[model samples]
Target: MIPDLSHDRIDRLRDAFRAAGYDADGVVELLGPEAHVALGRGEPVPALRATTDAGPLGTLVRLFLLGQAEPQAAVEAALAPLPLTDAQAAGIVVADGDRLRAGLDVRPHGVGDDSWWVVSDLDSDLRGGRPVEPDHVLGVGHASLSLVRATSRRPVGSVLDLGTGCGVQALHASTHAQRITATDVSKRALALAEATFRLNEIDVELTEGEWFDPVRGRRFDMVVCNPPFVVGPPRTDFTYRDSGLAGDDASALVVRQLPAFLNEGGTGQLLASWVHREGEDWEDRVSRWLPPGAGVDAWFVQRDVADPALYVGTWLRDAGYDLRSPQGVQKAGEWLDWFEDNGVVGIGFGFVTLRRTDAARGEVVCEDLRHAFDDPLGPESDQWLRRVDWLRANASAEGLLAARLVTADSTVLEQVSEPGDEGWSPLVHRLHRTDGPGWQHEVDELGVRLLAGCRGALPLGELLELLAMGFGEDAEELTRAAVPVVRELVRHGMLVPAEWAGGAQ
Candidate 1:
């Protein structure tokens, strides 16, 4: 636990920031990523490597990212363009000490709805989890967001959050559900979650249990379980990392039994793991878990595929132990042996979402796509709001794509091509076309050209025509190409409908 924040100190820090020529917002961004560096390393992080424009403040920001403690000497050496006041420096020093000791980084921005995060033993090493030390920023990897949204598909009468480490999903679900029953096995984890709710004054039913045992038969309208999905053999110290289950199959088992614990018409939102074996399809492995005739929209996205050695070695290091340790080496070999015995070629990680449609019917849809971590889906708890709205309004993919997308500030267009392809493959811009939908876009060269011009009101057809002239492609052909691209963007939230206030799925 960390010390309580003193308003006087915060005020002092605020004044210091102002004195150093930073407005409230600027200081927040400066502090967000740098704070992590400040904790991770003892020295101040340096400024931008490729650019010279960041100035002294930027240098200080880098110093902070390196986990530097009061780079006072570095500051003096660099002779910052805008110097910091002593009070500002002192307050930062105090704050830095507080954060470093706790192994936490409180981002200065976007902290709504269970925003506080501790770099997990797994996250710090594996390079996963919340981005920018805050809540889920909107329009991150939308597939994971899709998995997250699927959890909210239920009526949300009452929700249960299992393994609520930082309480990210729990806090978001709180607004939709009448009440939340959150459970975790770790006392440290529970306490951290308790502190978060207490600070925010959000109420949730808290309990200490190994999986469902604590809340057994205590049914909920929706059950959200983001368990330790890393598939490995048990460790001596049970943590947020290892579930102590035997293999990847454990997560599937949790999904299998989860329905029994949910209210009729309730949905079970599961971020799960399964074995990608030699003779078995990973999707088939999950299908065996769904109850007969259960209405399940199972989207199992194998975002990553790792073999036995790579898979076991990755997790073995997560427990603060390395394969170099003789015992560690032996334990790692056990995991390797287990995968080999099962004829598993690789492991699959993704979601198993089940919605109870009707007592007599069940369905499962397994989708495999490559996606990344969502670093910015914050405060948008009701994703279905825009999704359902777009569905109602557009009525078709073509219509949806025809809708205009408004990209926001600090957004970028990320183009990923299929491996071994010659053609300039489809490009998806990671832009905030609108709230509720912030994924990727079908950006033909013209769309990119149009995107460069999409700062204001411009007809989609006209944009395509402009691109057609530039690329020497037929304007109608370009428009046709962009239509499907636009629809896909809208469907995947790369281009959200206008007026979407951005809710979680």
Candidate 2:
């Protein structure tokens, strides 16, 4: 059962937690570095040892975080401002064989000084190593953190957190959005989300329904979802990771239906997985899932791809199944049989960003981004959307030639030289971005010369003519060769339009 936040002691509970130093920093100080990291990895032994006989803070930590029972008096002392009876009434704690234990998993979650508590159902380990219930409300995990890091936090008029499990996305949305509405298909998950928002004192509208059902016919400026995007046979074993729709259709459904729920210029960010079939491009397969002629610009970045066997193994372990057990073997065989019956060969996991536009045709760009990043993707994604829009507008030869271009400040030109008999000679030149996704492009002599002349001082057409004269080449031939290269550079933010560079930078 979820905690009841409507009780009168809710404010007192928050105050007691703060007074007991039960925040992120406080927990870190109590557990030290090693135990804290272990606890984060779902290992509780070190944390259990550290919290034993520690203090009111330690008692509270053991009870709520480590899934241990605390003596009645110790729990009472930790929650002093609020009575133990009231906590029990609110379903925050329950009697456990002469001791008290936390009924809900409450822990501090936030960055830096912004400390907020997240309340959700206990994990599988705490629940005696069983698969999660069908209506389980998941807490913070890797997928949620990925979405948080990738979501654009620009201030918006309205925001929607679709399938907001335990409200992690909605919590982040509250920082930048004026009106926040969160929806979940499960009522149990919604209850936990409501308690989380109440304890944190953030005003959010909670709705119950599947997908966009609760907020139908309404458009928001921004939408974020870390939906049940697992690509496999459709099953409702766990609500958090299974959408009850057949093989990758869950992700497809969300993508195809996004345009109708977004305002003009609205953006949707989601984590999705798509099937990779043999002899067919994954890009073409996913592109088919998008709405045709819907004016939705899309950019998909595939981060990882797993073969069928590895995919099945990973998800089986994720569902708290021991792979060596008989049940696991049987389940894996059945899942693989289903996969073989279909054309499934591999599964690709990644981030998908879509923007609604008023233009007639929208651009679709897909690429594999396996390289590590130096910075968070939030700003990088926003800049990419802007760059794509610019590229779409000046797509034709005439429009590009008339446009003045500037090299980005983060652009770095690297040249590799090899020693020759006489001296060192340049072998290859690569242009790399130092700040964003660390994208690098190999450039030829003509490409290097073109980039050198693009300082936002003259139109690209003039720069091409000047380079053609220097190389003793025809200007028309040089233009024909350089336009495509320039478009690629502009699309990746290596070069920016002179007029639009100021705000974008």
Candidate 3:
């Protein structure tokens, strides 16, 4: 179903939603916390029971959010300002006997007064456990939310949101970007995205084509994509998840091609998945997809990895297939067979952040950071690029030795103790960063003393000299040994340049 993008009709619909308080917080308030959380989990019985005899807000929730048919009079009263006849003509609703049923899903996203409505085809639950359509335009899902949370919000001249399903990323980008251009290969998705933008009163250039084809020869200051990156066999079933490219090629293609679309100093962020083959490093496979030479600096953080069986099962279930069913089991076996034939061992999922650089050689970091992080990753992403730039600028021994450095304020030294002949002898010492990604490093006595002396008062060269003299080691050798260690400390944000010290800097 396509949404009506007429400005007047959308405006009236927005007004009706506002009047009924059918927003994120309002819905949660009307249905208690338990019911709201249950609704989110796709168990609509609690919500249906709670909103059965409620008010206009409840009626709207039943019709639009829960996908339940309501009495025509109740739906009309719920959408007061927007006439029911107008809504029917707009294809937002259809008559089901004496009741009114929603043609599509319109759900609220964001917090407080900052919320906006997203329009898309009904999901499996709303569609009564039916399989999703081939060209189903997905609404706000975990993948989209993850990209939004990880993207840096710093203001930029222009932004491009590639494969913008329902235009979720574009909507958020509008807050910081001077202009936004969103593209999708599916015309139905573009239509729904248009309704999403129009309903929110946001102006964004909408285009249709596969991947970067829509914006050829044009560059943006920032680009964000949550592409159809599901790693699978070369088959096209769903437009939102299946790229129709064999195995991880779709992900590799996007990563390899994004550099050409970014302006100088511009940054790009994307979510991707890659095949982890036996006897091959996942890092090598992903990093090889990055642009060559000094064109872009890249960071690949693998958040999770799933073995082939689990991976196949997860995506099969996601496509609304019951694993116990014969069709599901047969399909799973075929998928596993394909994986076996192709040497696929596991699948790694994560975020990829890139920046255009002019250095002779760009820094590329690939790490398995699977730990839970409390804060949003946006600040860390920005800080990582800055730190890499700083490291590149101070790469030479002479350059690094001339600058004074201070340990991060969030850095905490912990001593692990074990009972011995003497009372509580120290077994080990570790340095931990309390904020950001919560990186931890094991330290020795020398490392402890080295960090203790980093108070921003002395140049690194002088500090190394003093330490070597005290330890009766060669000064030159100590400098050579400590340089790489210092670089690592700075890279993980355990230390910062004193002149430009900030938590994220």
Ranking by lDDT: 3, 2, 1
lDDT tens readout by residue for model 1, 1-505: 3333334433443343344433324534555566534533533223233112344454334433333343454444333322334324322323344221112332222223323222121133222222122221111122334455545433467888877775666766766788888887776567556644553457888898788888886787788887777776554334655666767656867777787777765666767778786778777877787755555434344556777788777665544455787877887778787777767788877655555544243435465645554433222323433343455466564564455555444346666655445756554534434332234444445666766765435555666677788778897777767676665444455444445424222
Q: Work out the TM-score per prediction.
A: 0.55, 0.94, 0.96
Better of 1 and 2 by lDDT: 2
Error of 2 at 90 (Å): 4.2
Residue 112 error for model 3, in Å?
Answer: 6.9
Query: Candidate 2, overall lDDT?
Result: 0.87
lDDT computed for candidate 3: 0.89
Q: Which has the greatest lDDT?
A: 3
Off by over 4 Å in 2: 1-5, 33-35, 41-54, 499-504
Cand. 2 TM to true fold: 0.94
lDDT of model 1, residue 464: 68
Which lDDT tens digits does candidate 3 get at residues 49-133? 9998888899989998889989999999988888888899877888889998887788889843578899888887767777788
The better candidate by TM-score, 2 or 3, is: 3
